[model samples]
Target: MSEEQLNFDFFAELSEPVPEPAPVKENVDGADEISVEPAALSEAAAKAESSPETERGVTPFVLRQAVLGYLAGQQPTAVGIRVPTRVKKFQVSMAACWIAPQSKQNHIEKVVAIDIFDRREHCLPDCAEREELLATLKTLKLEKLKLEKVIRENEPELKDSDDLFEEFQSYDYSASRNTAYHKLLKQISRLQHVIYKGSRMELIRQAAVADYLYLAVPAGELAPEELADGWGLLHVFPDRQVKVVKVASRQQCNEEGRRHLALNIAATSLKSVLFANGVAVDEHLRVSFQPPPRRRRKRL
Candidate 1:
């Protein structure tokens, strides 16, 4: 071939890219080949797509678990592992009981209770409101009787007067009483809520009086003043590290109350609360507290 022709052939070969292999097609009686595009996802991509990411949080449940683990990992009488505990009070939810000196199993050395924020409204009226309501009812009763007397004396037969008399005679204070009762209940609920939110120290004080060493977390602002007397604060960190802000040692604990907590903890399984964070406890504890494997419901 001439030099120019040889150069032309080389340039053509370089300019035309090498063709890639087409997807293999079925060879059936010279049938028309149908194209099928390959998936873009690689092996890793497929695996990743198959499983979605799980949600994470440092919620109170999580913090409590961390505290449980931290405490459980301790040595004797040294804030050791959390024993099964229960809430004796209807209002309090989280609680724990630890035996003292690691010797006596029956005696409860410490009772730790966490007071979380409760937004549930109360339903009851204040004393002043109740007194005012009573006075108002008394006034309405007198006015109703006086109006009835005037109507009876006048013997008015007008439609409006008749309605007024009938209403007075058939006046069912039950409805009014019911309305007032509900309002009072709402007031009470509000009072309870306010007592819990603004002045939760009252509840904490009650616990202290009961001789329970109470510990609250995220350390509320008022906790310093209200709970400062006897209550302790637990400061939990993101890295699952629990720092005890204020250590409260109960000098005199309600033995019965502490026992009730222990019994309640003993009654409920750990999986319900502690393992709620997706972390499992030790094998022995798991066996003891772990819920029976939830039977998977068959899909219809």
Candidate 2:
């Protein structure tokens, strides 16, 4: 009886199906359900370790393209060009999209100045704790991205290391469980007290003088108090998706200053587009102008 009982269902229970694990709980932002594996986290960590300690900034010219796209959507007739402005005696320039008058009746020009946030110059908090956390979260996110990239690049190798191949997985998924990535994301999302002093005073000038003012910044990155002083916010993504969070308010365009800026903007633009257009300055008035085409003498 003892021998039969011992041998009875030891093999039988193994043959029966096993129960599946319960579903994971998800949070509003879906960070709580983070599912990155340790291999990915390790790869991300490696990437973060290897990357330069440079702070994230609006160094990407691609963001301007997103702003340009938005301008095209809003003012399909407008054209973008980098233009210079005088801010407290400093000749600082920024990109501007200009929409010329369609009819002579209105006779007013439209200028949209784009203020690109540079994390290197902007987005630092006076509070050391906020600054440190912001930097830490960025590093963590970069590491997470690297981990994802490494996993994708070595999918075959990972698959070959599955337990079915008489080996444990090379990737240790337990370490990077949801808590880690989600916590980092939460920290980043909750960042505050990061003040950016107008990126440039020219931004304020643009708001007062420009027909439109647009703030173009990287996706998910923002200052504590964005330069939302009636400026439109364009959150540009790597995928080229632009989200317009606020509509720009049109201010009274400065007639004299705008004309001066417009001519300079047009001349600056022509240098790029017109296959090397030279800028000419009038000495007496200190005004800039494009040279008129030279007149050819008749040949005998």
Candidate 3:
């Protein structure tokens, strides 16, 4: 009650420091301890929302590229070119990256995410072409199957005693029929090319040099110098051909960088095939690059 005591107590209260808040534990592991470091929770949430699942066959990297490109009003082309490695270039599901039309629903199936390289756009050979090709193949396949069946049915008799074997051989129609059918099927198979317009990019064959440039070949046949990173190149050793292809980026390459690279490529070929649907870059293909035009000085 003393005036001195009241004055001292009031001053003590004024000088007392505020108690600190309890530390927050983010996880059971001490390593995950929460810090007071300032960060926007909404920013972290946005990142989580943006994170993509690569396991479900969706290339998160590619999808991101496509989304960004779309937002910028630039269309990115999909490349199905293959690489020899099994490395996961993008966080995506194998099915999404490998299968198409079926995995179209996958978010990664967009411009950058989709494999447009090995895509066979195959026009199903125009109705006329389809009808012609299918008819020949069906006919040849049917005859081959029939001949094979006939040979199997008469196998016992054909394998009879040695003396009868000679007589059986004399009357053998199976061998001749089989030969005919084989030849026919082979001919039909060649016609199968007529059935393939090539993948969608192929349909854009007109785009070759005109709009874009693409080559469909077994990854193996491709020269080492021609190979690009990130792509899984499947080569058939015997034929020296590339059987399957997909687009890939190098470890250091990011989606935006790749988009620029692709755009540059498209621009380079734009002058050549700008008017045609197809352009062939065969062994005889020759290209000579001219220096870019110089900028003139501005008048003062």
The best candidate by lDDT is 2
What clash pairs does model 2 have?
44-143, 44-147
Q: Which ten residues in a row have the lowest lDDT in candidate 2?
A: 9-18
Tens digits of lDDT, candidate 1, 1-300: 123321221101111112232332322221112122222212222232233221233455555565565445442232312322322223333455556555554466655554332111111112223333333333333333344444444444322323344432322222332343344334333333332332333434454423444443432222221232345555544455555544453435567766665565555544455655455677686533545455589999
Candidate no. 2 TM-score: 0.42
Candidate 3: where is the Cα deviation over 4 Å? 1-128, 155-177, 197-300
TM-score of each: 0.36, 0.42, 0.21
Q: How accurate is candidate 1 locally (lDDT)?
A: 0.38
lDDT of 3 by residue, 1-300 (tens): 223321221101111112232332122122212122222223332332355443323333443343223223322233222211112222111111111344545222222222212211111222233343444444444454465445546554543243333322222333443565456445544443333334222222212212112232222333211222122222222222122232232233333433443444334444445324343444566644444555689999
lDDT of 2 by residue, 1-300 (tens): 133321221111111112332332223243323322112212222332244322433335565565555555554333535455544222222444344555664333555566554332332223334344444444444544454344535444444343453322334322444455446445435332122222243334443546666555665666322332345555656655666544465666677666555555565565455434545445475645566566689999
- Measured by TM-score, the strongest candidate is 2
Q: Which whole-number lDDT from 0 to 100 does residue 277 have in model 2?
A: 50
